[model samples]
Target chain A: MSPPVAPLGWSRWLVPPAALSVHLSIGQAYAWSVFKPSLESALDLSGTQSALPFQLGIVMLGLSAAFGGTLVERNGPRWAMTVALICFSSGFLLSALGAATEQYWLIVFGYGFVGGIGLGIGYISPVSTLIKWFPDRPGMATGIAIMGFGGGALIASPWSAQMLESFGSDNTGIAQAFLVHGLTYAVFMSLGVLLVRVPRPAKTAADGGPAPLEGVQVSANSAIRTPQFWCLWVVLCMNVTAGIGILEKAAPMITDFFADTSTPVSASAAAGFVALLSAANMLGRIGWSSTSDLIGRKNIYRVYLGVGALMYALIAWVGDSSKPLFICCALVILSFYGGGFATIPAYLKDLFGTYQVGAIHGRLLTAWSTAGVLGPLIVNWIADRQEEAGKSGESLYGLSLIIMIGLLVIGFVANELVRPVHARHHIPAQKEAVDVHERQQPA
Target chain B: MSTSDSSPPDSSPSGRRGLITFAWLWVGAPLAYGLYELVRKATQLFTG
Candidate 1:
């Protein structure tokens, strides 16, 4: 079906909330940690096994978004949001059944395979619509939605903890919690489905999206063939890997860095540090991305990559000596990580135009899937080897930090390599007219 | 994808303003709640 176009006088301000409804709901996937302990104990599974559902969910999130992005663009945000609501909620309900029956694979299939599709679809669903509605401020528009993704965990972490507390941390409790999550998100995400609207292309594109150069549109197919896309793919992957290196190991890394120092990070303080990282991650999604509107996407990425690399170097140079310095570096690194995500859609709009930008963004998220595994693996592997070598304190992370710095340097070079797409990549004007005709018609 | 619920119709100036308020609040309230909880947890870093 063709997406619902905005009514003649619909406020552009309304679009961000619609996008937020879906993003905030899917952001709950980050809170899988909240269920990990209970799943490990109640399901009688290994730590690796307990991680299966979440790991698979991340993997499938990338796969589905990559494959399903075109469908989202063709079908519109309303269709994509509805699909997300169904898949995400049902994944939860199915996991509830799995927990109740003591069948682990069911939970993985439900949450990872099925619900993961929801995460992916839900993620890129609004990009095209928001960019269409707020071409003047695509960075800020997308920042609000992506920020909701990081912030989703803040809400779900506490809410899920409370639910597990009330329901007890046993198998029955896990099942009930999953069920409630499924039902609750279904209801909440329905708001996005109801509220989202595509711009009426002929009219509203001029109304909301009237940049003189915007008419030069690139197809999703054409976008991938450009060197610009691959450069960004590497840029996103390296930036995310750097952030995840610290994020996945936040609590432990904090405590370890300061273990032999004057001021040790106690377990409680380490927990607090993780909370601070989340704050930076959430705020940077909106803050730095919005700032990109002022500074330009390329310059903003210089901060994320060049300055981000400097932050890693500072950590390496300082070692375990300074507590406050360590926290400051890590927080800035994470803000850039989140900013990279939030600013990317606008970056794509700048390079590709709004035509199929959502699909292109979807394709770009494969970098995230790769980084999700690559980030944790690089950090954990290096840390493990360092520990085996009798390294103590920040020494365990010494090699990992250097490798992260190398990755950031590579990413910084990639950022510098990005230039505007060649005119050959833009969709031929004659063909674009035909595609626009097909787009306006219901399929 | 079709749903019974539609954007709150904007027939007049006040009606449109009400919608802008309602729309922002729909998402903003929960986000504020999340931020509040996050701030509460983060304070332990300084305090503890």
Candidate 2:
């Protein structure tokens, strides 16, 4: 059956908001840190125990997206958005129930597993559709949508914090917060599911131009066979690891870094720092990525991986010497982190063609899952050991920063390793000629 | 694959430019504020 087409007017404007609903809801994962202290104190859980929901959520986000990419492509954005809305909202509901009943595993299952599915599906749903709609400006289009994901935390963090404060940061408060998130997001995300529609087939091809560079197309199945894919995997893993290492500990790290300085970071100031980092993360998604379209993907990545390494080194070497320098370097690093996420889809488009770029991109997110764990593990483990050794403040994070620098350097090398695939791997001109001849001869 | 027979729309260049300008303005401010926050935080990291 032919899909119904709506008259074009304001519908295009509806797309990004639909994308935002899903992104903003799952993007709450970033604010999980705000609840960590409460979870620890109330549940009498260890840091590692409290981190499980977040860790599992990330893991599921990557895994489900990777596995569900083909399904998303086949089912279309509306279907994908619907699934994301249901799972994501349900995850919140489950987590709320778990919190009220004091079932940690339920929180993990609900928010981590189910919501992660929502994250994975919601993330890829609009990506390809947006790319199709704005072929003239794929980077900017994708950046605009993905930026919502990063910025979602900015809104959620403060709001969740307020809710916790009002409801009481006790277990009951956390439960209420979870309940509110589930109920509110269900309504918010439904707008996307209801409003989203796939572009008409003829319009889809028209939006880009004829002869959409099919020769360079690589299916997600074939994409994994190439060494370029693995190299990018390493590059993404390292970049995320470096950035998240600091991000996961933004509040404490900032306070510790400035503790010895004349103008020590106050509690409120430290919270503001975390908010600022979130903002930088959100902005970098759009700003640096739009910049990437001009400079080319590889060159922008050189900035992300190479300059990122330098930022980490400066942080480690200086050890909180000048607060201005530390903050400046970290901000640049986080911007790159945000840019890395935004620019990668365009990069995939450049290499793989748009055939199944969304799916390919989804599969690549496994690198994020790996870094999610690796970054925290390396940083927190080092910090814990340092604390045991009587180290405090900036000293505890120095080794972690050093490790992050090493990872970034490795990522830099991997970025350097990226080159255009050889012509042999490309679809042959003869095959294309035959296909064209067949089409010309009539079905 | 080469379907160029359709005539282009007759919108004035000024109109197209206006649309582009509008798009940038619409999406630009919030994006800039987000970046400002990053810069502000980075400044704090350095000075504080």
Best prediction by TM-score: 1
Model 1 lDDT per residue over A12-56, tens place: 777788999999999999999899999999988888898888888
Q: DockQ for every model, please.
A: 0.26, 0.14
TM-score of each: 0.94, 0.82
Q: What RMSD does model 2 have?
A: 5.4
User: Candidate 2, overall lDDT?
Assistant: 0.76
Model 1 chain A scores worst on lDDT over the 10 consecutive residues at A203-212
The CA lDDT at A137 in model 2 is: 67
Residue A170 alpha-carbon offset, candidate 1, angstroms: 1.6
Model 2, A1-443: lDDT tens digits are: 12123233323544566676677667778878789999999888999899888878888889888999877765667778888888888998898888889998999999889988988988888887676555556777788778878976665666787788899877788999898988988887776776565443331244432243334766678888888888898999999998898888888888887787787887666766776777778789889888877888899999999998898888888877787788878888998898888888888888876667788889999898898889889988998999999988899888888788889889999889988766655655444334322322312
- Pairing residues by index, what is the TM-score of model 1? 0.94
Regions of model 2 farther than 4 Å from truth: A1-13, A37-47, A100-102, A166-176, A202-215, A389-393, A423-443, B1-48
TM-score, candidate number 2:
0.82
